[model samples]
Target: MTPITRSTAQLYETDFVAWTEKTVQLIRAGQFEKNDKSELLLSGKSGNKRF
Candidate 1:
């Protein structure tokens, strides 16, 4: 069996704005499968807190 190698992206660290926009767009477009976080990583979830 061949092992699959996947490349990782650091969008959240490199460009947070772009990451947020992309995440929002994916949600609005109903592309849930494309979202990195299954729950959308909303505030209070995935360790994200609102300040």
Candidate 2:
């Protein structure tokens, strides 16, 4: 099976502002399914401010 890849994965690492903009846009547009759930969940687990 193919892994669920995140389009914003690199942005999350390189550009915090861009990543946040994209994520907020995705959420506001109700594109919840397109979000990187695994990444967010992992961030939540780690209590990361960057996520």
Candidate 3:
């Protein structure tokens, strides 16, 4: 892989991990906001209780 592409992928992975951790913390603390909760309710998943 190209150096630039590899670096970008690493950065994206790190950001994604950090975001997931923060989201979990918010959920555990009952601090999740309505707008953010809407985003987490993945369309069809919510309909089927897949979450």
Name the candidate that leads on TM-score: 3
- Which residue window of length 10 is worst by lDDT in model 3? 34-43
After superposition, candidate 2 runs with Cα above 4 Å error: 1-14, 41-51
TM-score of each: 0.47, 0.46, 0.62
lDDT of 1 by residue, 1-51 (tens): 865444324543557678778988998999977888644544664687432
Taken over the whole model, the C-alpha lDDT of each candidate is 0.67, 0.70, 0.70
After best superposition, candidate 2 residue 1: deviation in angstroms?
A: 35
Task: Point out the higher-scoring one by lDDT: 1 or 2.
Answer: 2
Q: How close is candidate 2 to the true structure, as a TM-score?
A: 0.46
Model 3 ranges off by over 4 Å:
1-4, 42-51
Model 1 residue 38 CA deviation (Å) reads: 6.5
Relative to the true structure, candidate 1 reaches a TM of: 0.47
Q: Write the per-residue lDDT of candidate 2 for residues 1-51, one digit (tens) a residue.
A: 875468667656668777778878998999988877655643465586433
Off by over 4 Å in 1: 1-14, 42-51
Clashing residue pairs for model 1: none
Clashing pairs in 2: none
